[model samples]
Target: MHVLTKVKQPFNFFTESVIDLDAVNFWLQKINPLWSSNKALGKIVQKDIAADDMVSVMIQINRNFKFGQAGQHHPVFVAVNGIRYERTYSLTRLNAQHVLLTVKKVNAGIVSTWFSEQAEVGQLVEFGLPYGEMTVPKTASPLVLLAAGSGITPMLSLIKEMSKTQQLKEQPVKLMYWVKNKSDAAFLARFENIASHYANFSFHVFYTQALPADARVNASHAALVTDLANSIVYACGPSGFTAAAEEHFAAAQNVQTEAFSMSALVNDDIGFVNVTLLQTNKVVSIPKGVPILAALEQQNIKPKHGCRMGICNKCACNKAEGATKNLVNGAQNTERGNLLKLCVSSAQTDLVIDL
Candidate 1:
């Protein structure tokens, strides 16, 4: 294998002078599916149903896959019907060569449905670099984790890392997870084991559909732990749940959050701007002050996207021309040749972007 790699390196460099590297990779893949020169590829090693519609996949990655912080999300690329699609999911590292990806099947999610029902062991998948800021903090402050539905994915990753490092034993850690039903929760057994081993670590699962009905994240939820003003909180879930977490922990020392699904933007702007897709040579009139990704999708023009909250750069494209506004920070970009994350950017004027 070493000799073949040494020979292939110079051979590929020589062939790229005349042929595209992708073509070289296409031929090389016939010998070994993981033999990509640039792309990070992984093979599915195991699969299971974690929750009602959530699929858990253990992927054995190649050397090209760069391990990331525990709470980061990685962009996964898969093809369906010869059309490639990309989506981001939070990944939990099991070892240097393996990562766990848990995905929930959305009603009409194409890639998600494939993973849930069609993906098979030994199937190859492509991955991009990881991106996120919800990693565990270095502070020794009391830690609180709030998760809802699929938001538990990242929290699980974070908790695993903390347990490995014995952080769960060193400080007070509380995890409060919310799900529609008891069966909607994942990793209940693992949480129980952790709590049993570490008196400092505790977890609670809130079933919203219970007969008595459990309240969502609110001021009463704050009573789950003492020292609310000094605890560092990490919350992930749908938009409404994370928003409520922020409100509930407003008095906390710090609150970090990421929402898997975004809520509808409620901007007051009422105008349309023409967005030109240079690659497709098509034009779309999108509403001003609305996210470019959402606007384009409304016109049935779907571009690649992941973590629609702007943390993952999967939907980012080159802005050949025109100005755009950052929906998150209200910053404006008028410079040509700037890369913009479409999920969090709005067209401020007529724009040309590579799609």
Candidate 2:
């Protein structure tokens, strides 16, 4: 009898899934279960007076918040009675799990009030990831760090990191900290400790407002340049202060600068000029000397900005159509068909911008 052999059908494997390695890895990392735990959840630790008007709020974050490379800022979000506010502060301490931020309380800032008056230990706040492109280079060249007022925060981080890692031998690092007074100096003890410990590191504290009684030698840009001539210089401060410093270091080839506000663009009389927002088709007259960003802000329209001095590329907008005059250098630089920095450029004519 011929056995009815069941013809074994070959397995088709039609429903098998093929994974794209890159996509699989991306989703695995982005949507991983651990991601939820890594979100910024802040725990108020302690408060200490870093200076007369400046205070340090210690925050303990969960899930190992990524530490910045010496000189970077993290935006802290605070909520009080359901009102949320955010402000960016530079990390004063480097390579530490707990983040320390020093803030000078503004007269009427919401978050500043909460930090100065309401914040308590163990209270939970929110903090964004570390951001800012101002970072220390991994070079062995001589380094010059300059800062004013609270701008010294990031420079402190860089000095501390260099001291901790014994990296001073690789480069001669000098700090030129400019403050209004002795009491306005933030992280003085830490800076003194670094200066004392590292022979390669030098500290020069300049008091622009008033010199301290205990100050042996007053600090000046000329003094710093005399010591570390032709060295790579990094500076941060208010726009006016940075502008003055920048002028001093203009001859130095290796000078880099970061400013808190673009106040330099706000001159005496930046007369009004008409600007047309290309995307919105709205024509707004902006004062010539006043920054275009400020004009937008006055109209209740907030434009993205960082340094405001044409240094940081934050307030860059497409000049889809029209001409502009840059008053800073008295140069009639036009951008009829490209991106322009609204912080520095004023509308020369009825201008169109991709707002």
lDDT of 2 by residue, 1-355 (tens): 8888665433212112323544433443464422222346667688988887788888776663666677877766678889766566787662345878777776676776677778888787666667666677766777888788778888888877777788975678878887777788888777777777778888877776783333222234646465455677788877666667666766564767666554445445545767777667788777666567778989888778754556546789888776665644434656567778887776665667888
TM-score of 2: 0.76
Per-model TM-score, in order, reads 0.81, 0.76
lDDT of 1 by residue, 257-336 (tens): 88777655566667998999988899989999888999999999989877677777779999999998876545689999
Q: Judged by TM-score, which candidate is best?
A: 1
Best by lDDT: 1
* RMSD for each of the candidates: 5.2, 9.0
Instruction: Give the lowest summed-lDDT range of ten residues in model 1.
Output: 1-10
Residue 29 of model 2, lDDT score = 40
Worst 10 residues of 2 by lDDT: 9-18
| lDDT (0 to 1) per candidate | 0.88, 0.69
